[model samples]
Target: MERISTCLKFYLLEAGNDGSIEHVDKALIANLMTLFFAGRDTSGALLTWFFWLISKNPVVENKIIDEIRQNLAENASPKHIFSNVQELGKLVYLHSALSEALRLFPTGPFLLRVPNQKDVLPSGHKVDQKTKIMLCSYAMGRNAEIWGEDCLEFKPERWLSDKGGIKHVASNNFLAFSSGPWTCPGKELAFIRMKAVAATMIHNFHVCILDGQNIVPSISAILTMEHGLKATISSRWV
Candidate 1:
């Protein structure tokens, strides 16, 4: 309530400058709707894919559980587990696993762009202003040239540096959150949310993907499982 009231006040103040409270209100509403949908849907999809990937790779799941337990300690209170970004930041392996999942199954799998002017791509392919180009992030992520021979494998270690820290990749090559000025504003929020939820879940539950379930990406604006993930989750906590 306090945050909403504060936002309303700011919107009204801005409206005072242009004498357009109605327009400002509409814009504010639209912005709120976009934030809610984008934040929830994309993060939900990412979590789904992340869990599926981890299920298929028990080593990765065990590593994540070990990391989370080590960071929070075995007797840490449930209320305080991964309660802050600082603590969550220390889960480097968890972060790497999330990154690997995003690499394979990006929520926004395709991006469309129209060049403002005639241009030549690195491939020497000519494109003009009228050309509409669709860049497939899913295919790009699986490309051998970009991700090497084992690109199709779910390997979180690939994102870890020799020193065991999260290795930064160029945005052009890793477009899970999009790139440039138009990048998703909630990118950081999404990571924080995912980490908190993932850590808490993994710390308390043993998630198993039901055997023989055929999972594939659905045809939608967001990358979702075609049949959804069929998983049996059991409590890990005493």
Candidate 2:
């Protein structure tokens, strides 16, 4: 709550809460609650899945570690601080991996809402004024019709273009942060934190998944590991 209040105060300062802000009391509470619950859960779940995926694939894991090491070599004090945002932003492979992971296991597997007015989605789905809708981001991500038959495969290279640049991954297919006015504001922050944690952990240790452990998704609005992901970590340098 303290963290939420602190962030809200910063927001209020940035927006300059004028007399017109009177009607925002309930809205503020709702938004704060949404952030409080959504922020931590989504990030935790993402990192869990990321680690699990990397553990299963040593080639990918080595690639991430190599990137981190390369970045560290360029930094004067890599353990203390991130030297530059430019370098962080250039983590194209990491970004692609994260995108792939989000596609496979979106935090909010499904989104629910009712249309405020009659509308037609790009997918040609028509909704009347009071129609309730369930947009399955999870299903949309793995749909062979949209992403090809290998949609279920974890391939980060799909997010890169032939020019070796970060490709414009479509938001319609990947709605982890959602879309439109109700999208998560902390999307960038969450991605940065997730990538940073994954890079740091992979660079420092080699994670080996314990044998025969059934790691499944939990039943919740926010995606969580059904069983806590258990893995053994060995020092990478060794």
Best by lDDT: 1
Error (Å) of candidate 1 at residue 37 is: 3.3
Worst 10 residues of 1 by lDDT: 1-10
* Model 1, span 2-119: residue lDDT tens: 4445555765676567777787788778766765576788888989999988888898999998888789955777544566878898999998999899999999999888889999
- How far residue 200's Cα lies from its native spot in candidate 2, in Å, is 1.0
Evaluate model 1: give its lDDT. 0.84
Candidate 1 residue-wise lDDT at 122: 97
Model 2 alpha-carbon drift over 4 Å, by segment: 1-15, 19-37, 75-84, 120-126
Winning model by TM-score: 1
The TM-score values for the models, in the order shown, are 0.84, 0.80
